[model samples]
Target: MMTVTRPLTGAVVLSCALSGIAAGAPARAADVGRSATHRVLDVQARRAGLTTAAGGYPGWAKTTAPAISVRRSAAPPRLVAGAQRGIDVSRYQGNVDWAAWAATGVTWAYTKATEGTYLRNTYFASQYSGAYKQGLIRGAYHFANPATSSATAQAEYFVANGGGWTADGKTLPGMLDVENNPYGATCYGLSKTAMVAWISAFAARYKQLTSRDVVIYTNSPWWALCTGNSTAFRLSNPLWIAAWTKTLNALPGGWPTFTYWQYTDTPIDQDYFNGSYTRLQVLARNHA
Candidate 1:
């Protein structure tokens, strides 16, 4: 595994460059055509308190959600020698060292593609393709913003930017990162029923566009509170559970088991496919 040298405490950036960030509060559709660099800058601005409760990259929801925090493990488990090791990155990671990661046994990755109806990852081009060059199975993910736009609209936006799925065995299905609202409300102002409907609508639209089932990345408690533990997607969509503990525990939304487990966040977010390398290939080919 890639040896992470970053400290255990929350990774903090005390200062941020906010010169490119928009002034005051955000408009309903201010992100429509902004540059990807500026989009990432906006997230940094929010984290630095310029935009307050605006938006963030993936795993941002882990902070403000319900009692989901636990004593983090020193390192994520290996399970077995052939465990399918992986990592997820956003513009926050900038350009990555895929070669070093591959040398350390990282065989797959998910690169953040888009958020809301706009704001794509600035480093997506490099990060997504760089992993592929290293012979790693890679895919894209969209951080959900249910309050800003329709689920279908966001899904279309996500796919259009870079979340598209390919049948190639190295290309996994696109993922929807739905969790606590990084903005104001805990559930993005949507009630439990509305949240479930929103997710279902997004999944259906994504499938309509790609003819592939979408993988959902969410926290268990957040899922319970936001979707009322809806079981509508139990069989169809694959689960990518975010639980940063030593071992996996109770799952959310009636999913019998998790397909992908995001078990930690230190130097960067790390994950593992639940099955073997061949099984991971099956999922990539949309067979699993």
Candidate 2:
């Protein structure tokens, strides 16, 4: 690992090492030529020609990732043994009938809370509270806009709004949704090294504030493209992998298995916890 501190950028020190690049090297196409995902994201990134990036829309990732070349033919099993059902909700899912979802066997959920360092989920109280009322293990997520603000600042904003976690069985630790930039450059205009630093900084800050490691929600392709598949957060952050296949195919580098898998966007970003309901409670209580 390499220690990093920039002249500006609000004291977000970084210490993660990359495969083939120096910690301070400028981001370039050659730096991220590790996989097909990297190549595809690079092409789309150049084609997009975006000058800036912004917006922390919760569910925009699925739309942006299709341009990348990650089509998994094998359908992931709809039901896995010892796994619990889950879902993610946002204002777009407005006034969600949590009771309706719970009745369908949805036992866990994540609600969109904050985006970047400015916007708050307009319906967070209703959504976050409603999921718990429906007897589901629910949590909040921050849609990361790495280009719009410092990662630490965004993490602070998220916790100040709705990202805080308690030891209660019903509330899950907060999650960070880092994926393809919806409004601009694919990697938020940050070099892959800087992207790794940004995420490390955010995770560190969230843990410092909440005493819990934030769950990282991301897809494999975007992660490879933006962060160069860095393994720095694998040990500290539980992964909530967003693979829209019928089941999980290839996971991002580092994690041997996923804690949560968002399997599809249809029927509302359905997911499955890779454990039993009791284990789910363990996760919520920070005992796992």
Candidate 3:
């Protein structure tokens, strides 16, 4: 088991210099073209205060219908010792029977909130409120689209809709779903430096708005490739590792331990919040 010693307080800045990506490497044509677009969005986000309600903002005011995809493994979930059970849900699960689900000893859940700058989950209302009403701690996450829009726009859009925290004890802090890019290109078509900066902008804005650190959800390989294996966020956010294997062979992002492990995607994306159940409760936004 890994141990975390850093207090979740200030934002951590990662070096712009990624190890694998040579500093002098010629810029990719795709990145060069998009850099202009990304800068505009960044500027627009700055003009609107990060904490303001996400109305009239560049991405916040826009709407784009999103297609949903659900994929789950057929294998049974692997268990981690001394971990509290949890689950993450999206439109793929359809309408959740929160009562039935909670009865299974699931203590917490994270649901899909916003994707990119436009698409919001269709079932977010039912699932988010249903989990809460069923006496389970619940949080929302944004599926990142670094290639399509700036992180600031997406971050504001996410918190404005469903990712905001209220200190109600039932609320779990927002999470950033930064894994495979659903759009074109594997690393969201971004250079490694841009990837780190995009994530930094999102995390900074999220912390500024919610007064809480966001949980990062991604696999070790993705983290290594995208962010150059930077541990910059270790001090400010919790790590949600997505490793489906029985034995966790590797962990990334500079943290010695993981807070959440998505061990399986089968039977509704089962997970373990790495701690005692009571400790999990204490991590809730409004828990007294």
**How many steric clashes between backbone atoms does each model show?**
0, 2, 2
Q: Tens digit of lDDT per residue, candidate 1, span 1-288?
A: 011234323331111222223344234222222122122223422332222122454454332323432223344333554669899887656557788778878889999888787567767898899999999999999989898889999999999999998888999999999875654566777888999999999999999999998999987666776787788998999999877767754677767667888877666788888878998899898758
- Sorted on lDDT, highest at the top, how do the candidates line up? 1, 2, 3
Tens-digit per-residue lDDT, 199-261, candidate 3? 999999998998888888876555665677787987778888776656665567667667888
Candidate 1, residue 58: the lDDT equals 49
TM-score-sorted candidate list, best first: 1, 2, 3
Off by over 4 Å in 1: 1-55, 61-81
TM-score of each: 0.78, 0.76, 0.71
Q: Which scores better on TM-score, 1 or 2?
A: 1
| lDDT for 7 (candidate 3) | 19
RMSD of each: 8.0, 13.4, 16.3
Pairs that collide, model 2: 76-246, 76-247
Compare candidates 1 and 3 on lDDT and give the better one: 1
lDDT of 2 by residue, 135-214 (tens): 99999999887887899899999999999998888888899998766545678789989999999999999999999989
RMSD of candidate 3 to true structure, Å: 16.3
* Whole-structure CA lDDT of model 3: 0.64
